[model samples]
Target: MKKRLSAAISSVGLILGTSLFSPAGAQEIDLYVDTVTKQVYTEPGKNRVKMGTFQQVQKGANRQDKKSSDRQAQKKTDQPAQKDSVQQARKDSSQQAQNEPGPAFVHEPLPERPKEEHWYDRMHIRGYTQFRNSTTVSGDKDAVVYWPDRSVGEDTSFLIRRARLILYGDITDNLYLYFQPDFASTPSGSTTGNFGQLRDAYADISFDDKKEFRVRLGQSKIPFSFENMQSSQNRLALDRADGINTCCRDERDIGAFFYWVPAEIRERFRELVANNLKGSGDYGVFAFGVYNGQGANRVELNNDMHMVARVTYPYQFSNGQIFEAGVEALHGRFVTSNGPVNGITPVMVAPAKGFVDERVAVHAVLYPQPFGLQAEWNWGRGPQLNGVQRLITESPLTGGYVQATYKYDSGPWGILFPFVKWQYYEGGQKFERNAPKNLVNDWELGVEWQVTKAIELTAVYHMMNRTDVLNAPYERFRADAVRFQVQWNY
Candidate 1:
């Protein structure tokens, strides 16, 4: 009985040892636990190398898993919050679009640029008008007086002496043009027709870089005399000197002229012109031209062309005073009339032909600051009615005018100038009908007062002696007149 019992115990021991040592039973187990929840879990497919006790390894794994799960939960919570923010932004943008009104047009920025100017934009326009009243104070009403040209008329009357408009501008940097017309003119001796007349239509071509040299083309003032070149608006005397006037009647002709001034004196010349102080602009220190010799408004009757030249020099004092001297010469052929010659008299013989005409003149001027002096003298040979020959013949001629003036500037009252002029002329006026001989000695006293920049008043008293006018040969006459004039500029 004892042996059997021992055998049973041995058998039991063997069976338990075999099961524990088998290959499946030898595989290691890795256990993991959640530390916070205190739960156990098995990690499959992992080899267990004993680093510490099972509880320590399991506790480390459970702590790492718990941190990872916490991180994931936080990420999940943040995603929904970010999505809500995006949806809210979309909603706000939609609300703003609905609140604003739609624009009518899209805004576009304009390119900045300069305005272009047309050619006419550079044009300058100006004009003047004159009203005059004259009366004969010493001569009979029907008697021919010393007054010549348009100044000769009925004794006591008011007349429009001049109404003129001027247009001028530059077409390019080097080209300039000027135009002027007169509306009020006296009736021609040949016809009662009095109409608007063109005075100047010309262009200036500059050659030098500084424009010190130029050529003037078309109808322009002949460069024969300083006074003739001086604009009517600037003249101190009511009329131009007879000496110069006789050479080139009306002073303008269709011509080509060369003008030149030294660059140094050009500014001074411009200042004189701008001041309207009895000086032509830098027309030149030297000038020359060729023109139709028959005078302004008359067609050329002969093929011969008139040639004119002038040389002038100006000196300025430190006290703003100017003195100028000039010499002039003109040569031309003159035809008295285009009418059919009757062949009865010398007058008819001369009118049927052309004659040599020549003139030389010298002039000096002292621009009136407070005191001034101006004088011109001329001598020439021209066609004249010789009373002795009872026919037209070439004869010696001489003429000139001397003037002195005193100017006072009263500030706001404007300028006042008192002047005296003496003129003597002995010549023949071929332009006048019948080639009338003219013998004139005249004295004029005048006062000019400038009320404003645009207005001026002048009064003149004249004493004269004249001969051989209006078909009367050797008939001497003395006449005097008082003239009043008002001028306005615009």
Candidate 2:
């Protein structure tokens, strides 16, 4: 009877304890889980727990309490495992979604990248070179006087005038980059080979297909005269501007420019040459902020020009010709060598003292049939240099040019183009018994032959008369030159 009673009491305690210990507290799904751990577990009363370490609870804390403690410890231990399991589930869900798709896609858009980072997205490359040999039968002068060469005068000569390499590309949909390097002839042929001096480095971004709301930054072409912007890689003539004012170097500045292009054409442009622009390829308005104006990769003692602005229009004629026209203004601040009463100081000069360096200009280029013509005119008033006693020119200065070129498209291995250029300019200090009115006029005859994609040959004859001088003798300085050149491009 006593044995039976003890057995019955033991059975009751066992039942009660078993009922209280619930595996539901583990609260897990989909596993034959043992509920063991990959991490340490702190019992209901224990301190901080660390992963992959062992922990134990004291004995006789109710012994029953110990069992409960172990279960509670399991819940804590599973916290991290729960996180890992959740991640795995998500990954699986995503894969399933991809497999069941009617064209899988992401809801979020991709991030945009800078132009420099996406250089090859939209890229274009081009390059050219010219060489020539000429037999001279003329007067006893050399190349343009500014750059005198005694190597060959009125006699025959062989030369390489242009050896060039160019790289141009676009980034994203609207940004662009362009570079040109002249490796052929140096400023003095071999005497000065300025390799890798960037010919052009600028980032361009535009709003749309019409290219409105555009910005260009870095070292780029100065929006100035026609000759200054024309590319040397392909000048229709052997000699540009009769080599009078055609160094065309210093035609760039390190700066940023803002521009707006128009979508429509105008009547005046159509009438002028079927189609014309402001020397700008499209109709637009432009404003520039130049940091250093003495071209790119150069250092100057004086400050650079502050602003250059222009309004322009283009015309597309029914005859398949194009023309452009524009008006522009400029304002610059600088310190002149003429000033600084003391050596340690810098005295600023007033650029607008005598006249408005403000200028009015008009340009037109015509492409009709076998002939092409381009012309520009500029008239502006400028500050006269202050003499020890002020003596300035009475009126603003005027300068311009009218140029024509005739080209015959490629036939066999060569293309022939003959061109003529004429210019007239006068702007100088009148104060000096030495300073006088200035003008330059030139005439050239030349032809080019392409020997290969990378090689070109050229031959030419030129004559020039320069009238800009400080008490220049005999009204003008004249020259006659004969040249031939050969070049390689890479």
Candidate 3:
């Protein structure tokens, strides 16, 4: 009896041990992360492994024997069903857990919200002031001389040509003004005078405090040419863009322009400058209603209201580059019939001569990382000369320029952008003869130092490289001009 009792106890112990160590007691599972597709795994020491619904657990229940062999056989027959049942139980538990929240702190509290930038307290008082020395190879040669003096070197000399002062303040939240005055006109040509001209007197209004959509009015840049309209204060080179905007000595115009930008689009922008999207120039109607048709340099006004407009489209590529393009057009009225005499003698002939002024332009560029290229062309009717009448009529003059820029965003000296530009221009009736049938070219090379967020400085050297016969007389083929400027923003 004692032996039978001991045998029973041993059998029970064996059965319990088998169940405790069975595959049912423990199972292995695999998991993977969604995006990285990396194997989802848990540290051996982690409290609990975070596993998703994906699971495969095959387990079996222990076989308990009865007194009869048939009963033992029956239990063996139930092994498959029992294994299925165990796995099903695990699946059910996983589903229930999915429906319910996980145990405490499944995800950590995001690093405390970064302190929001205080925009209201931010009143950015930023602008630039620069002193420039200019030496014209020959702006005054014809002014004081009856006949050209080959030995006088009268056409080549340097003087303090421009003294610029710019002030822009965030007066209150919605209202702002940019008043930049240029003290220039140390005339070296025929006359010498010191005069001050208003470069920018614009009031900026925005829909929101952040200035997403803005409106600017007053004497600002005309949205005509990139080189023409780029703020002289921010230019990386010297002299001008070599286009009509600079070559014509017409930089700013008194007008108004509205800016429209999409929120997503703004994010993609490189944001080199806070107001990079703000076009100092844009296309709109009644562009001539408020100001003279000629650029800022011309004091005369035309008869008809001038109109200008621009449209730009941007595209994004998978290779992580963004490109954009735009088109612009303007029309105005100017005295086409002129000369020392009069008659319809437009040299660079256009459709409407001696009456209305019309200009059309288009520009496009593809901006890749660290590199950008821009090009533009402008054709219009302006003062013309009569080959027939020895008079100035509405003549057509065209100006265009191309430029390339390369930048290294990360350097010991902060972001550095060096660029090269070339331009072809013809405007005055006499100058049109010099224009090549196809094109002419002016060149420039320079580097910009973005030194700091509040301060920017640049120096550039400029030259005109064209055949003496094809390039404009003012567009003398040989020249070397250096320009330097700095800006401070509070």
Considering every candidate listed, which one attains the maximal TM-score?
1
Q: Which candidate's lDDT is highest?
A: 1
| Residue-wise C-alpha lDDT for candidate 2, range 1-490, written one tens digit per residue | 4543343344333323333333333322221101221111122212212322112323455775646766676766655564454445434433432343232222445698755654575677777665555543444344333232323344434555555567777676687777776664354224544344466678888878655677888877766555455555444455434222321134666778776655444233233322221122322444445445433555553544546666655455687655555665555432222222223222223453222334556666665345777777776654333333233333456777787766565667555556666766665332223223455665666666556545656666766566423222314567666666665555
Model 3 has an lDDT value of 0.50
Pairing residues by index, what is the TM-score of model 1? Answer: 0.76
lDDT of candidates 1 onward, in order: 0.72, 0.49, 0.50
Better of 1 and 3 by TM-score: 1
Off by over 4 Å in 2: 1-124, 130-144, 147-160, 184-191, 239-249, 262-291, 300-304, 334-358, 381-396, 410-414, 428-438, 448-457, 467-476, 485-490
Position 288, candidate 3: lDDT: 25
Residue 423 of candidate 1: its Cα lDDT? 86
User: Where does candidate 3 have its weakest 10-residue lDDT segment?
Assistant: 144-153
For candidate 2, report its TM-score.
0.56
Model 3, position 200, has a per-residue lDDT of 73
TM per prediction: 0.76, 0.56, 0.54
78 in model 1: Cα distance from truth in Å? 17
Those runs of model 1 whose alpha carbons end farther than 4 Å from true positions after fitting are 1-103, 112-114, 144-156, 190-194, 338-345, 348-353, 468-474
Q: What is the lDDT of candidate 1?
A: 0.72
How much does each candidate deviate from the true structure in C-alpha RMSD?
23.2, 17.4, 17.7
